[model samples]
Target: MAGTSTGVLMAELTTTARATRVIAAVVGVALLLAGTVWGQDDKFPFGPFSMYAGVNGPNEPAPDTRVEGTDSTGRVIVLAERNAGVRRAEIEGQEGAYVDDPSRLARIADSYQRLNPGAPPLVKVALIVREHEIHNSSATGRWWDDVRAVWDRPA
Candidate 1:
């Protein structure tokens, strides 16, 4: 009788241990999924330019400028100053305009030329982030990926 009881107790202990491990694993996976979902909702705030094309003064840097824009359909127009009398610009956008619009690139070039005609010629100007993340706490598992573009200038 004693031997049988001991064997039964040992079996129950093993079963309990397995159940605990499984529960832990499930909880870990659930937390991971929640974290990923939360991360996708994160947002970074951008800016408010004075003139669409002007000597816009410096602004705050946005968080994670390395990450590309989520609006893949929208275009990213970058104008950089290349040298004394030259500037470089590129427009990356969805496929429609490139095929249909003949004046788009020319318009951009003309705008830059008109804006900085006599000035140093915008030696280098590009679409860049000027803001950063503003977090209140250091707690782990907080999601952060959304981007908000505000028109108000930073103080």
Candidate 2:
């Protein structure tokens, strides 16, 4: 009688576990479908990955944005994540805000100085967008820099 009761309890637990899994799977699928239909980049894991979903024309110039700083020593430094602790994607995502408010770029320079204490202080910071000339869906080894925003320290 004891052995039969134990077996029945195990079977019930297994059945419960299976039902829970099914419900979770159904909810996950529903969320994914809904996210795909109406989600933006901020929705992340459930949303359609917009970066991969985007398409560029074969002959369109591809934009590559970067932050550049002119230090006191008169050297132009490319402030990448390694140097400035700011990612290119982060800058690109807020391109418009930087354009609207150029002073915001001073924050990036401050970030760079904080990360590299020994380095020369940045006197000028500029947000540059380099458009690589594309032909037949490939780079043509030609590009132009568009200075979108500039932040100069008060000397």
Candidate 3:
């Protein structure tokens, strides 16, 4: 009778342990799904630079453009020009040194023209600079800057 009781108790304990493990696994999976969903959702604060679609320049004021959507890589993609518009433009960057390369700029301009046929060429392009900080275990801190371009078309 004693041996039987002990066996019964051990079985019950084993069952409980197995049940707990299963519950934990389920919870873990749920948390992982939640995290992925949250990451995919919009409304998250993106990078430092925000894109302006219509027209923004030195003398002119910024246009009232809404953020259409953000890509999976967190790049802000906006519809600067739509519906067979004349011009289109985009600016993308992360933390790094800021430089305005004419070759790259020309490519961007060409892309804009192609995307938005009949749109006026980009008259002005401005680069907004932002700073980022990185920390390392070697007790060293590094700071870098990045830039995003803002282009404007003649109205």
The candidate that achieves the highest TM-score relative to the unseen native structure = 2
Over the stretch 69-92, how does candidate 2's per-residue lDDT look in tens digits?
A: 999999999999999988886788
> What are the per-residue Cα lDDT tens digits for candidate 1 across 97-150?
422543333443445557557532222222233344333433233334433221
**TM-scores of all predicted structures:** 0.20, 0.75, 0.25
Best by lDDT: 2
Name the Cα RMSD for model 2.
5.8
Q: After superposition, how far is residue 73 of candidate 1 from its true place, in Å?
A: 42
Please give, for residues 1-155, the per-residue lDDT of candidate 3 as tens digits. Answer: 22474466323447889899999999877766665556322322321123332333334322222212222344344434462122322333221222444233434445555775766554443444333332332312343433354444334
Give the candidates in order of TM-score, highest first.
2, 3, 1
Q: Which ten residues in a row have the lowest lDDT in candidate 3?
A: 62-71
lDDT of 2: 0.89
Clashing pairs in 3: 86-118, 86-119, 87-119
Model 1: lowest-lDDT 10 consecutive positions: 41-50
- Where model 2 places Cα greater than 4 Å from the true spot, the runs are 1-13, 23-43, 46-48
Estimate every model's Cα lDDT from 0 to 1. 0.35, 0.89, 0.40
Once fitted onto the true fold, the runs of candidate 3 whose alpha carbons sit more than 4 angstroms away are 1-102, 129-155
lDDT of 1: 0.35
